[model samples]
Target: MSQLQAEYIKRILSARVYDVSIESRLHAAPLLSRRLSNTVLLKREDEQQVFSFKCRGAFNRIYKLLQENPVSGVVAASAGNHAQGVALAARELGIQAVIVMPQTTPGIKVEAVRAFGAEAILHGDDFDTALAHALALGEERGFPFIHPFDDPDTIAGQGTVGVELCRQHPEPMDVVFVPVGGGGLAAGISVYLKYLRPEVRIVGVEPIDAASMHDSLKADQRVVLPQVGLFADGVAVKQVGAHCFEVCRQYLDEVILVSVDEMSAAIKDIFNETRTLTEPAGALAVAGMKRYVKERKVSGQTLIAVTSGANINFDRLRHVAERVEVGESREALLAVTIPERPGSFLAFCQALGKRAITEFNYRYADSGTAHVFAGVELPGGSDERDALVQGLTDKGYPVLDMSHNDTAKLHLRHMIGGPARVPSERLYRFAFPERPGALLRFLSAMGQSWNITLFHYRNHGAAYGRVLVGMSVPEGDEAKLDEFIAKLGFTGHEETDNEAYSLFLR
Candidate 1:
């Protein structure tokens, strides 16, 4: 073996982490295996004492530092898992630990560090500022700064995970997916796995919005990202560390980038399989592995994904739940246009026969045509979404699929409702089936002689779909409109004179 390989392998074999870190389980994912037709395994490092694999590297690095030379205390800067890891390790060793975290760091993480008996200092607003302050503090206090991922000892410590993987799985393996943030974990795992197995492919996974390692690998040099998405905050690093990049460049077979939705879907997948919710970063390897399996159509191969941490903030779950469907291609958002006439909305609903309508919103913006923002649950995934769009376009509806539009998903849907002025307009509130043909049948019975101005419908996971409709009647048609509405076979009432409508939608 080459000296570099020999050195890291020896270091990994001798690393001191068991004193503070456990050998996490290599769990079989039967459901995921059946879905992909592959033998999928998840390395559950999220089950660590700190609920993260970071303690392995942090403990090893600090333990080794003390062995070579006596140190009274240690200092480190991190806003997430690493801070907790370092503080825990220092406490175990009976040494003082100073952790500098960003002021914007969640209170949960700050309190977690303090719980580990470390001095938690809030400084700056972001990680970079906290890091600078930590470095300066270390110098001022004459204490060693425990680098999160760059140091040789740290990488060696993280490499222990690979040692356990080989010992535990032992069977033939096709690929191992490791999450890359600053590249430390990837570097450590990739080098050891490649050296020991040589043939097993080691793939590094990164969030597309924070893909410093992937970009660096492609460019054959380190490149800093201007900014990174914080959905997976644990791995939202702007640049890969120098030592980590060098090691990963040599050891990793390839790097995969995944989107925020993919990660969210992956978190859901992990939860479905293991009954455990992991932070977004913890699910990166699974997200990348799923993408790889889909892109390559590879089946029956043994694949492993390292679930790195579970330090998720509770509030992020709602956002994750909202985006998981789109991430998995199980929902499609659409913007459809129909004529601003009485039967047009009914015709639109008819075109969407038998498919569950998830959302619908409209307003009387123009007299000639109206735009509708809609969401449909896709039982058939992307293929169904494509067919639905094509069918709508073929049937003369101008459909713009916003399923993949992040901005539209995040903001445009909520911003779609507002006041509009329409002369002789009458509004009605109605409830119909949340299912396929209820709206179609109700609107069909209501007749198409008058001009339909504004409409809104939203499915709230209930049996009934609530709708608000506005119609233009030429004074004489009020009774005619009421007569048609009374026979529509659904519960509804006129809201034209309602004070709330006058205040908001008039």
Candidate 2:
């Protein structure tokens, strides 16, 4: 081992974190293991007192600072998990703590800091701004600023995780995946693990949009990302820390990137296995492991993922759910062109055969051809989805695979309709079973009747699927439209005069 690795190992052994942090349990992810045909283990750092592994680093640094020189108080800047860790540490040591958090920080985290008996100050709009204010406060008030990452003591503190891993699972392991944010956690774990088990691969995982460590390693120097996506806010650092980058550059086997959808799917996988929800950043290692296994076609080996934190906003679960299917390759979004006629939808359904329809959207865009936005459930992932698309193409239907299209997934699905000049446009909402042939049944029932002008349906995994449809009805034939709907025998409500339709879709 090199001198730096030896030093980190020594520092990690003597780190003072047990007073404030627990030795989190290592869990075997049975569901993930079965699916991947490998033994998948999760380092359950999310079970810490502050619901993150950060408590270990935060406490270690604070303990060392107090040992060297007694301080009355300390300050820290963090938007989420780190602040809670710092606050919990200070409370345990009976010292005053002030945590400066971004204005956009979730209320749960801010309140969590305060609950830990630390004074939480909301300042600035982002982490950088809050960090600057924290530094200024530290200088003016004669308080030491506890860094979220980038400090030697902090890195050593995080390294305790590696120590526990070695003791808990001494069996052979093919790879250990660590999440990389500012790089402190990765650096700590990599140095210790690599020094002890040179044969074990230590891979760091990062968000593709916020891959500071990956970019820095490629450039052979720390490089700041111009901007970062906040979806995985915990690991969205612009630049890796100096100490962290140096250690990681030397010890880490490699770094890999995962997309937001992949992270979301990993979160779902964790929930399925452990019945626990993790933040996007917390699930990074799992996402990376999945990608690595698939890309390398490696199986029947031991793999570990560090589940870092669970400090997620409850509201964000909705967005996570929406993307998880796509992330898991279990859903495909497509734009298909079918002739603008009464039986086009039924023909499209015939083309799809027994495959389930997750979503369908249409509007009266053109009289020549109608564009349909659809989400098809995929039981067999990418290969199956490709075959389905190819099958549609063979039948003379033009298909645009929008599964990887950002705009199509995020915006176009919801905004596919607007005002149309159809002479007698009327809107109605319908509810039916969210299963195969359900849409076909609806389309078949309304066959060739009064020109279906608009249609939208999305399956939310509930027993019933909801749909909004617009139809062209001659002025004197309003009763006939009602009769047509009554005969269809589906539950629905008329929205022809709905305020939203009047303003936009009408």
Candidate 3:
């Protein structure tokens, strides 16, 4: 075995985490385990201090550093759990500590560092920027720099998780999924596990948009991403660490890239299984496990997925909740155009049986056409949705179903209405079947005569949904539009000039 791997195993065996700090409950999710036909165990590291396994490494590194140098103080840069870990470790060691964090970091994390008796310095916009500032300060102040990861000691410290995992489940595991940021957790656990149990596989999970480790492993060397998606902020690393990558290259079995949507869905699944909210990065292991089972077709093998952290921004939960169903393939979005006529909407609704409505948006101001945006629930699968869309098209309605398209979901759907026709003075809200061809029927019936001025629709994670629509019509066209709308059998309102709708559009 490599010296690094040997050292990591030795450190893991020797190190000791506070009894209260080590999480023991390995949750067995029957729903997920049954799907994969494997005994799936979750390592609930989110139960650790600072709500992350980072504390394990921080404490281990600090303890080792004190033995070597007996430092009076230490300095580090981090935006989240790392800062809290170092602060708590330094305070416990009776040593002064300084943490440099980005000014954009949440106030809660910043305050938590200070509450742990560490001096906190608000610096640049991100981890790298704060790290640069911290390094300069460390040089001038003569304080030891405590790296968040990358150091041998830190990697060894994190390997303790592997020791715990093995002790918790002595049975052989086919795979152990670990989330990778700078590759600290992955490298550490992989090194320890491979050395101790050569038969077990170690897989690293990273966000597809921030897959530094995946890129690095592919290149057979470290590589940096020009941009990283910050949705999974905790593991939004641009580059893998040199030390961690070296270990990963030697010990990790594979690296998997998971999408933000998959991670969001995994977070929702984790909440359902464990009733605990996890950050996007925290849920990555579970997402990876699902991807692995599907891709590799592995069955009857035990799997362990590490639940790494739970320090999620509460506001972002709204976005996750809205996209969860779609990610899970339970909802579909569609863009359809319908004839501007009466009774056509009702015919479209009848074609789509009991599916729920999640969102609806329509605009009727274009000189020759109107558009309707709709989101439908498919508690069933794609076949049912395709049937609904085809049924509407068979009835002579021109339907465009974009529910499965990502571009439409992110940009076009949110801004469906524009100044294609005369400006409208009024806005209206309406609801129709949240089915594939429902939008097309609604648009076709609105006809080429009326103009749409504004429209907005988003899936609100509900059964019956609502849509905000705006239209420009001639003074006497209200009766015609109402008459047309009433024939559709869907509830609609003439809020064309409503203050709230007008204000929101403006």
Per-candidate TM equals 0.90, 0.96, 0.85
Error of 3 at 385 (Å): 5.1
Sort by lDDT, top down from the best: 2, 1, 3
* Count of steric clashes across candidates, in order: 0, 0, 22
Q: How accurate is candidate 2 locally (lDDT)?
A: 0.91
Rank ordering of all candidates by TM-score, starting from the highest: 2, 1, 3
Best by lDDT: 2
Work out candidate 2's RMSD over C-alphas: 1.6
After superposing candidate 3 on the true structure, give the runs of residues whose Cα lies further than 4 Å from its correct spot: 381-407, 418-497, 502-506
The TM-score of candidate 2 is 0.96
Pairs clashing in candidate 1? none
Instruction: Give the poorly placed runs of model 1, Cα more than 4 Å off.
Output: 124-126, 423-454, 457-504
lDDT per residue for candidate 1 within 1-506, as digits (tens), equals 77888898888889999998999999999999998899999999999998889999999999999999889899998867899999999999999999998886767778889999999999986666788999999999998999888888899999999999999988899999999888889989988988889899999999988999999999999998988777777887788899998888899999999999999999999999898889999999999999999999999899999999888878878789878888999999999989887788888888987787777888888778889998888999999999999999999999999999989998888778568878798998998766666666666776778777777776666788888888778978778778878877788988889998888778
Could you tell which candidate, 1 or 2, scores higher by TM-score? 2
Query: Residue-wise lDDT of candidate 2 within 330-446, one digit each (tens)?
Result: 999999999887777778887898778888888877888988999999999999999999999999999999999988888889888788988888889998876767887887787
